[model samples]
Target: MSNPLQLEVERLLALGRTPEALAAGEAMASDWARQGQPLRALALCRVLLQLEPAHTRTPQLLADLYARPDAPAKGAPPAAAATLPRVPLFSQLGREPFMALLGALELRTFKAGQNLITEGEPGRSMFALADGQVDVVRLLEGGERRTLASMGEGEFFGEIALVSESPRLASVVATRHTVALELIRTRLERIALRYPAVGETVRTFYRERLLANVLRSNPVFTTLPPEQRQALARCFELRLVDAGTVIIEQGQKGDGLYLLLQGQCTPVLRHPDGKQSAFSSLREGDVFGEISLLLGQPASATVRAETPCHLLRLGRDAFEQNLASQPRVRAALMRLGTERLLHISKLLSGRAALEGDLRV
Candidate 1:
């Protein structure tokens, strides 16, 4: 509440400018949404919606707040709220959301050597460990078991069930007598409908974790130091694009560097003969638009989503501030662009040779 936007909202309220205060508060809510403070964003959104129900951005804002992800949840940043800090999954929820979930949670007990969740079964709920220990295991394709992780008190698992009807990806077994709090998907989603800010909170946590994981594993980013990688992750904006969307146009300046998170994309170069040919396809974990962004030139190829795509974009201004300002990171990006360009050139040369033969 002490941030510039919060302060502005407070000052406007003090002056009895209720309409203006609500307006500024809405903007502050957006800041919270983007900064991994979803509960705060949700609380503010709820407040503004109540005050100005006709706000043009309500439906879309709420939809996005529920669906989109952002930077890592820092356990309530400046837009922080008083919330449960036990399970990292629900640790960032606002007071109302925490209370709503509290009512829906059921305490469950499991004896040692018992299954809490069996892999391949329908995932009906997610659980937060209240006491004791458990093991997370996955069934390998060869019929062997692989222990993925060990969970102790305050840890939670099986969250994807809350958002999707997907089957459980892994199994949880109690290593000892365990006490846990379970929230069924039916109940949890009821809260989502009632308080979409809760949706925003969950969305925030997901993106925060996802962005961190993606950056940590990205090929180019892996070369950067951990601290630098984290810094770069914070600057990225995750975007969703529909199939057939042209993200980068041939011969046009790229708006930013993009890292695909989901779906498929193709980079195609148009020849002088009014024909378009794909140079390569991009999939999850692939990076694009860097060559143009790094070299300060127009895009040499057009990149379009061949399937619905989720991507992380780092804008030019953000790049200048975080990546370009650091010599090592800048050089790494430059090297990547050079390597990709060389590959594209070879692909083009091969294509041209084939086309020339056909002309003969």
Candidate 2:
């Protein structure tokens, strides 16, 4: 389906309403960024940059948006522990284990403007900043550079890549002469296997980070207090489903609510007569299956992954056990469900009207 915002921007641009289109695009981009969907925000920014290449503020805005801090990951705890410092990932370990981890780390330095990690390169290890600063920049299509963030003393980067054994999402460059301690995955794995406590600490930290990001991204969870959000986060189970997988079949009993952390899915309604129509798409930060879960009814539509999806699922039992005490969350979910139902009603009405017009 065509994006209403994009269509509006295009219409304005066709009418030579450059200023209006720019303003609209800027507002939409800011909204998307606030909703924690950076890629969508960046897409809007790209359009604005393309139309107004000379607009100085657009580039700066893109940079600022990119520079917004992500949920903190495992990092060095303190500089007083050892030469490498006490990182949270090793916080629970005894002195011997901690020292062992510290010994495994290799201290590295880079000159100003030197790249410590490049986008799309395999990440074999994670790094903890010991001194100086590093800038995280993502290269966009057509060779544009967007600065994602900056890191200083004790901050961690590349942990996600290391954990998932995936390519780096962005490049990390030394903004100045910098010192960092590199933790190779293999060494870390060995330490973790030998010390279950160390492994659990890292796992807990990563899970918390994932939960925090999902909570921040999703509008329904935004109203939840930090403590409550943390409580709810612990109740979720992470699942990775492959592309084209049907997650929730239409008319099936809904057992849980799902929060999409990464990738996209489409909610499609299938009629008994074998007709199917996708009404909307869900991307990162979007929640689904809540309607059925809350109402204790069958799912109204099928949800299929459009890409490999990373999801956090909160089953009804967990929701009742963990979230029932939070009246605010319950109220929020009810309100969201109402809004979603209304949206579906509108979509159906619009389709019916179009069908009627076509028949005439």
Candidate 3:
């Protein structure tokens, strides 16, 4: 008899119904399964799985079909069906909803005491723990060293270097039989495109983590979880200035915004009357130049460092470009802008009310 299931799959594909074709293909595979035709079933299963990694039932059914006897007889063993990295957490994450997109991630094994990453070294890839344990350690002067933390299965590391674009913070060493899924930067960039939300989610997650880790140390982001605060931080770049540095002039075109991340500074606002007034003192977390950056106007004030300072500066072009790329960031900034306008309206209403009371 002609294979009715295969006929159905062909008809669906002919009609350009990819979803239905996949479904029909799966049913045909199942029919093959019932007849113990493992090889035939697995062949059909392969095509379906590739088209729809998120197709819920197909992965499990394919797993079952591949596990059946004679499935491996016709072809090399399926790569997906291979025993997952035996190290701690690799197998568990492979079952996650997003693992299919992590196709670029590769399983890597290392012997105990192997260095996963070294401090002060450049990094090209990040790793997620699949099995065993690794230690975050730092070597100090005088040959002293300290263990900062121990990470095990399902834990991820090396993300700081990748996300922050910085050198590795600390050395990582496998303390036992270890396995991990190494995610390369190129693959991550592709993931960022295919699943931009994944990158946004990851960025938000990392921002919060960094906030908590460096809040006390970095003044630029002390106000946690506030859209305005985060935007002000992200919309700028850090610049180091010596104690004698002149940051701004009293009357010049303001091309950027600035946020003080470290050290001390003084603000001097010059009036049209040829008089200067001390506007405010600046310290860590304080922001300035935003008035011009936001208004597209000239500088109304001068800024000079009282001491060596680290300042985050964001030029208009860079700020606008970044906002154009990240929708979430643009949304956050819009919300902040709305809030500020509303706040100013409320203040004006209160002042008008006070003026009426005096008139009365």
Look at candidate 2 and give me any clashing residue pairs: 76-87, 77-86, 77-87
Candidate number achieving the greatest TM-score relative to the actual structure: 2
Clashes of each: 2, 3, 7
Please provide, for model 2 over 1-360, each residue's C-alpha lDDT reduced to its tens digit, 9 standing for 90 to 100: 334434544554574537887887778767664554433444455556556755545434333333312211134223222222223464445544554565466646677899999988977888877556899999989999999778886677777644566567789999877766677888888987886766766666666777797797676778888888888888888787888999998789988888887678988876666767675578767778878877887887889999777788999899878766677777878776776666556555554422221100
Minimal lDDT window, size 10, model 3: 351-360
Superior by lDDT: candidate 2 or candidate 3: 2
Task: Name the candidate, 1 or 2, with the larger lDDT value.
Answer: 2
Question: Tens digits of per-residue lDDT for model 3 on 157-177?
Answer: 765444544456589998976
TM-scores of all models? 0.58, 0.65, 0.40
For lDDT, the strongest prediction is 2
lDDT leaderboard ranking = 2, 1, 3
Mark the regions of model 3 whose C-alpha exceeds 4 Å error after superposition. 1-100, 215-360
lDDT of 1 by residue, 1-360 (tens): 133433443454465437676767777767765665544454444445445655545324433333323422334233232231233654455545654565566656687899999987977887776556899998988899999889886566776566555567689999977766677888877899998888777655545655666777776677678787777777888677888999999899889988886678988877676776675578767778878877888998888889777788999898778777677666777776776676656566754322321100
